[model samples]
Target: MELFEMCPVCQRVCDVQTRRMGTFLSVEQLCPHCQFSRLWNSQPIVRSTPAGNLQLSTSVYVNGESFFKLEKVLKAINLQLFEYDTFLRHAKMFIEPAIVSNFKTSQEMMLRRLSEEDKIIPGGDLWADSPGHSERSGSHTTMDLKINNVVDIPLFKSDEVGGSCQMEKEGLERGLALLQEHGCLDDLMALIFDENFVDPAPFKEEILKVTITEDLCAQDERPVKEEVIESFVTQVKTEAF
Candidate 1:
């Protein structure tokens, strides 16, 4: 619904709309005064005012950057009753499921599109442990040599991927398991990995088709084969095969 009123943030009359789907509520209000746009990702709660008018208000927990704005507003207004840190953490609990659901949907769609293409190759990456992390994280993504469109598969911290040093093989094995779990066919033209990367023995036939690119420098001290693939995959992400 569109509303004609002064914006609370910029104090200008503008058109505002509120939409709700399932438990998710979105409020978009643009300020003509400062040309600033405000979006609120919240969950709705219905209550009756003293005047008997039904009013909708979001709880302290909300998603994304707008939630921080709400905190700023509260501080500006000298409201100290709310627990900012607790609510901040709770908001993530509310938002992570939706993020996961959306990611799965996108992955399925990408896989479907890739299945239709005959020339696309499947490759993976074995990243060394990242900073501020205790374990190494290795993962794989789909690469389309035809259009060079790389569809990245989001890897969560909890995802079964292992460290590149010791867990490289385990990481690749987990990646293949996920592919089979998704019902992906063995239509991949080639599997690419680092030269000394451990073999995924479970899928030996599938692993036999693995391709290793020569390192430009010494070829021996070269980075893992999947390193190049991972870099390119990170550079370009598109659904088009």
Candidate 2:
């Protein structure tokens, strides 16, 4: 069993790593800082150090009496450190909640600040998906506006919320309620959305329910219209016996 050692010239001399495969053994002398490394391969060479007698590389010079190992170690290490960098950049290394929260708070603050300065118009998209191949088991996403900075809302699995598509509508309502709470709904200029989203009568009704201002931008259905964002609020369930 050969033990790995440090570059011997590191800030804190420590053990370098070795990866072994059967009879073939590989060792590295890696620097803690500059990340320079010298790879060596050889049959386990036993030598004496101040620490104790240990197995190391036969190629490395120790005393005047140097004996060669029957086995030879291949000396090759790629100059580019892509392997090390890719491993370090892996997604699993991230703390998801902290990252999400940090960005979420920053974006919300930015939107609020912008709204205060100008009548910032925002839009929203409602997303729905069923992972389990059942409507009841599907999930719904809240309104996400590509315009103003997006607010991160936690996903609600349908199973957890009575397995209903209605939750998606609720998510839309939740976003509208948020804007209302911020006291910026009255400044809403225009909203654009797909025509099939709902009936025009109910669509107008839903808008009036949360109407903060009298002027609801209305126009004749154009044969061709530029893309507009849909900003709608769904009804919230009231608890009653």
Candidate 3:
């Protein structure tokens, strides 16, 4: 601030002007005696967009942070920030597409690796956006139990499945369908699910009939004692390891 407030030509105090755009600051200094002037910016402009502004917006979104909360923090600190509209624009124009593309690439690589395996055992679970059967959306995620790597994640909307209660079923069905499409079902030995998950009667009757049935049928279980469940899980983990 001090350096920018002085004029080099006359070694005197100069009039300083500041313009703020989002996280970027522009400072201009002018000397009345020599009529000398200079301008400086705190950040570089990339294609007419402030680099810091775009960086802050992208970082907040990719890190699962709330822009509204960040805005409040910046305001409390008297720092300059872009508006919500700009943040949304950045997300729509750049961040979301990048995320989607990266996800597809990673999933494709994982599926390709699984295609080479003779047997694959994946553990899956459904998680809802909200508690109980009133959730608006659900995510079904499957992980390779052998490698402990996530294989796939399918998201389902309640409206598409008639009601929120059916979101879990929809997510499960979609995940299975995706695996089938990728030819991973041919190598799938067991499909592990949470003990409390809704029984997949449809899968037993329709999907698993002819495709890798032996191990899956062996794993199909009814409610049992807590100790038994723990023992079975331990056995499965030992085999996987």
Instruction: Return the top candidate by lDDT.
Output: 3
- The reply for model 1, stretches above 4 Å from the true place, is 1-82, 85-89, 126-164, 180-241
Top candidate by TM-score: 3
Minimum summed lDDT over a 10-residue window in model 3 is located at 187-196
* C-alpha lDDT of candidate 1 relative to the true structure: 0.53
TM-score of each: 0.38, 0.36, 0.65
CA lDDT of each candidate?
0.53, 0.46, 0.83
In model 1, the worst 10-residue window by lDDT is 48-57
Per-residue lDDT for 178-202 in model 3, tens only? 7778887763334443433657798
Q: State the lDDT at 143 in candidate 1.
A: 46
User: Which RMSD values do the candidates have, in order?
Assistant: 19.9, 22.9, 15.1
Between 1 and 3, whose TM-score is larger? 3
Clashing pairs in 1: 136-163, 194-225
The residue-by-residue lDDT of candidate 2 on 125-200, one tens digit each, is 5455643335443323333344545653545656666546566666666665666667655533333243224457
Candidate 2 stretches with Cα past 4 Å from truth are 1-93, 131-133, 136-148, 159-163, 186-241
